[model samples]
Target: MGAEGGLRERKKLQTRAALADAALRLALEKGPDNVTVEEIAEAADVSVRTFFNYFPHKEHAILGRNPEHLERALDRMRTAPAEESPLTTMWFVVQDVLRDLESDGQLSRRGELIMSSPTLLYQLMMSSFDDERQLTAALAIRMGEPAGSVRTALIVSAAGAACRVAMDLHKNAPDRPVVELVREGFQLLAHGIDPAFDQRGIS
Candidate 1:
């Protein structure tokens, strides 16, 4: 909380970001499974031991962006209007922030690679709970409720479901824009998913 603590956290964050960026580049240059921890550490300008200090394993380095992005979303959510519902603000802010990431066609290509690869897909989905925990805490404070309250639970559940739905839709229609998938996912969450399906079938 103090300046010293803040400095330490920021420095750690920088190291983590660097490590993930290096890993991503390596994965694209070669392949995710082909890239080694030492390679990523060297690319990050750190020793392999120091890499372990930031991430437990090579896969952790590959998946580290999820937590980093969630942290950014929390910072943005903290600035939401006080009068607005926390669930709504958090949802919109997260989507908006991720939309920026999705807009980068290159990064989305990385995402597509990760999603298509059977090994990374399972790990990414499994590790996503870490992000959900941070989101639940942020929403709880904003909603003036306990972290595990029904509202918080519902919001987290719905938001997570929407994200998965969007990803699945994106996988099916790789040519479609990510924003369109996200928009359609949110619409299904707002109304009934059945209606979206029915309309799509009619189209």
Candidate 2:
């Protein structure tokens, strides 16, 4: 019975992802303004009602507003070794999340769409603020700090900023692996900004 329940949940998630992917693909080919919910449903081979069940509207579908991924990241954080530093655990969680996203191939397409559409990019940035809040809360819980503590907030904010910078670098250098860029971004955080500055003139 438990296995059956889990399988059913997985099917639901797959269906939701399919719908979102279809919407994104269509939006990429034809502008978001021209893509309708019905067309998205048709592309995904699901009924319009099913599409609505997964997303409130076309915009949400295009943005892929699923919180399950974030929840899974939090679960990874919770399971990380107690002795690991919060930054280390959080970075590991980010890598896991990005690896899964990169494997899906949808992330690169979404980045392209976001870059091409000013409105979509603005909406994505707004949605990221919500993601940051959720991540900050999860990190605080893992560190045993109060949900809204300053330390957690600052750490999460810094991490978020680092990721944004890494993503921008990835956008510019699509040939390079995003995870590698992300690691470099974190190294900047760990080693201090402009690590080469002191030796620049001497060499």
| Candidates' C-alpha lDDT | 0.72, 0.79
lDDT of 1 by residue, 48-100 (tens): 99998888777777755545566677876677788876546656865765665
Report clash pairs, candidate 2: none
Best by the TM-score measure: 2
lDDT of 2 by residue, 1-203 (tens): 99999999999989987888888889988998899999999999999999888887888889777767678767877787889877787687677767666766877667666666777767767777787788788878888899779988877677767766666666788886767777887887777787667785688
Q: Alpha carbon lDDT of residue 126, candidate 1? A: 70
TM-score of model number 2: 0.82
Model 1 RMSD in Å is: 5.6
Per-prediction TM-score, please?
A: 0.70, 0.82
